[model samples]
Target: MTPATSNGWLLETRGLTKRFGGLVAVDGLPLAVRPGEVRGLIGPNGSGKTTTVNLLSGLYRADAGEIELRGERIDRLRPHEVSARGVARTFQTPKVFGNMTVLENVLLPALAALDRGGHRPRSEILEHARGLLEVVTLDRQRHALAKELSGGQSMLLQIARGLMVRPIHLFLMDEPFAGVHPTIKDIIMETILRMNRAEGVTFLIVSHEMATLRRLCERVSVMHEGKLIAEGSFEEIANHAVVLEAYLGR
Candidate 1:
């Protein structure tokens, strides 16, 4: 268990650092996200937002710092282990199994969990998977091969798959709205909000869409050169001088 002070945070990191041959991709960073909060992480390209997500998701191991989820250290776990711990994430680019049907792609995670001791009935799991497809507006495409879908549709598939991982504690969404049509973007945003409000799911969303962040996030954190520069409500961070300088320059 973490110290009492950290109990309030669903996810927390301290002095988080990572480097690729001295590039210092993530440098001495600290982050905290409260339970059920939709928090936005924004920065210019190469600001370490995705790198941070990768570390937290265990795709890339950290060189320094610790990651705690509900007070247990998870930074050392493997990717599958992290997922088993109830951390799920979407990537900047949609990743799907081209050969698999859309419904099969969504079913993969839950089926994997069962292999690892999850006891949910197969019938119930299948029904839940179909329901998630409906939420993402992809129910009609359930029979199509994943590779046959458009880029936007592939993104929706990725989200449904991510949500299929049961017992999700925190969801790390990276650039979910990028290149998506406005209508599809609204659907994605609504799905996120619905899950957050109805399921009390926590999210750490990394996005560049300022307007969407303003609408979906209770608070936003700004990063520059691998370090956090500002954090506050959208209105507060929007007016922050340091944040402006980082994005617009002097």
Candidate 2:
């Protein structure tokens, strides 16, 4: 049995597997993310990187294996249940309430965080929501409709919403740099790093932008055919034979 120990790591998945009909989308995989660490997951298309994220976030149920977040079993819970446990995630395609104002979009989740019996007043919740917008540099856009924001602004809003929840421990972000302008990408990167450093939140980032991942993550895991084949620092994975072969198909 995998020992239940926090050990400063925020997440640990052992023998995680998922199958879609006859196809195995995720093979037996074991992965861990330490608190305040920015870990990257990378692979060719359909290598199960996103599937792992889905499973971790409770968007999809795993076929087998255990998922422990801070030493607690959470593999069988629903998405909201997972979120309530201090896990929040953003998708490859950002999902925001387009009909709502930017402040409201973020405020909803923050408000939900209060549903579990909190004594704070409503004004405090709204202030916290605005603070998250400030962190994402979107405080000026608070009253703007979500659909009025540009692509990069939309992505930032999604991230801010995830963080609006009080004490969000880990964020599983998928393709956060996708469709974002270069300058805005830097803003997003800075936001993530700053949040991790300042608040001690952990991150499991799944991104195709290799250069950005290299700059951000302390360690990276490479996957192929639904299995993690290589894991190391940026320099090590760049020159790894198997990783090169997986990318080069040699």
Candidate 3:
């Protein structure tokens, strides 16, 4: 469902398109995400969900169109520049620094951002890192090496690391619950909800979990063959005849 607001979207894309070689990965994708809103993106394999994420995250340059964050144009920013502009993302596979301690991996982004801002105090950075670890419930594992953590813990670490930048918008989560234990999945989901509620972080999540998406997302966008096929509330899209036929391979 659209949030009750007039012209108050936090992120919007106008005719976003991307292509590679002879393939059109995404085509004329128009979407809007309000502040603190959770929007789900779903589609069958090769439907361009990941490609859309890549374009939004600045990992891939758009072949056409623009992206606006809080109404500021940001489609041309580099990936790191995008992060600095209050956009952060977590990959489908956790990319923890295996050689570093759990705390170090989480601390990297905060420290880097701070250093770039001309802050060079080690004690201050350490303290900030500790706080982030606490936020993700990883303070107890502060000294543990990244590679030693379980899959769920790794996912938590990835999210915690993303938050270290204090992003206003987040994108690029794919199959977040994949291969994680049920309890850990619950923890991850709870953390996501808490971030949105308490910090006003906007999210564009990509996943195949219909039940989870229906429960968490205010709006759902479905893609097919690199084009947006449906856009509506979860119930509206879930009950759509086209969606059923697409999912059931009819």
Candidate 4:
């Protein structure tokens, strides 16, 4: 895939800076994600990867910066407001409602964001939920309680739930493969690629798994000590001396 230029970016963050008390978490970060592009964010611990996601998702207000989703400024919006604007994200831990059935969890987003004329009938919503479950290969467990699912299954369900929002711009995924098994990890990765290709869902994935990130992302951004120190294709980041030292102590 070609790199997203400034003009065609679906999501753009300019001078995005965030701070917690005296500690700067994300410093003057600038990023652009194109429609349908899967960009990876990789950095060592305490590199502000999760902090950046929080800021973008409106969990934390930026001390400075601007975030635009499809050219609309959204940095100051509340989390739910951000969601309503077509931005969806999955946390590192599955955030599904534990007491809800798998299908119910998937349907919640759609129900919450129902607009005046766009609301579907109950039967149609159920069918749509089932289709989302099928996309994640979780239709077999659609009737099960969310809390009963394994870690990997819960992760897939989280992604499916995010899709229920019908996002058009971006999906911010935080450490999606952190604790998943290799087989399940492959399933999730493949599903992500398929979604990007089939539905034009842009992604900004944060992960420590270099191999997985390299395989899944066309471009990568490396953060360290609250700063975005590098941004380029995986090969460029992998070969950078600073990145090598950051990952492997000199």
Per-residue lDDT, model 3, residue 122, is 75
> 73-169, model 2: which lDDT tens digit per residue?
9999998789988888998887888899999998886566568665567898888878888888999989999999998999999898888655578
For candidate 3, give the lDDT.
0.81
Clashing pairs in 1: none
Worst 10 residues of 1 by lDDT: 1-10
TM-score of model 1 vs. true structure:
0.96
lDDT of 2: 0.87
lDDT for 168 in candidate 3 is: 52
Pairs of residues clashing in candidate 4: none
CA lDDT, every model vs. true structure: 0.90, 0.87, 0.81, 0.85
List candidate 1 stretches off by more than 4 Å: 1-6
Tell me the RMSD of model 1 versus the true structure: 2.2
Better structure of 2 and 4 per lDDT:
2
What's model 4's lDDT at 88? 81
Which residue segments of model 3 deviate by more than 4 Å? 1-6, 118-125
Error in Å for residue 165 of model 3: 1.5
| Top lDDT prediction, candidate number | 1
Rank ordering of all candidates by TM-score, starting from the highest = 1, 2, 4, 3
Task: List, residue by residue over 139-230, the lDDT tens digit for candidate 1.
Answer: 99899999999887888898899888778878999999999998899998999999998888788999999898889998999999999989
What lDDT score is found at residue 118 in candidate 4?
53
* Candidate 3 colliding pairs: 1-218
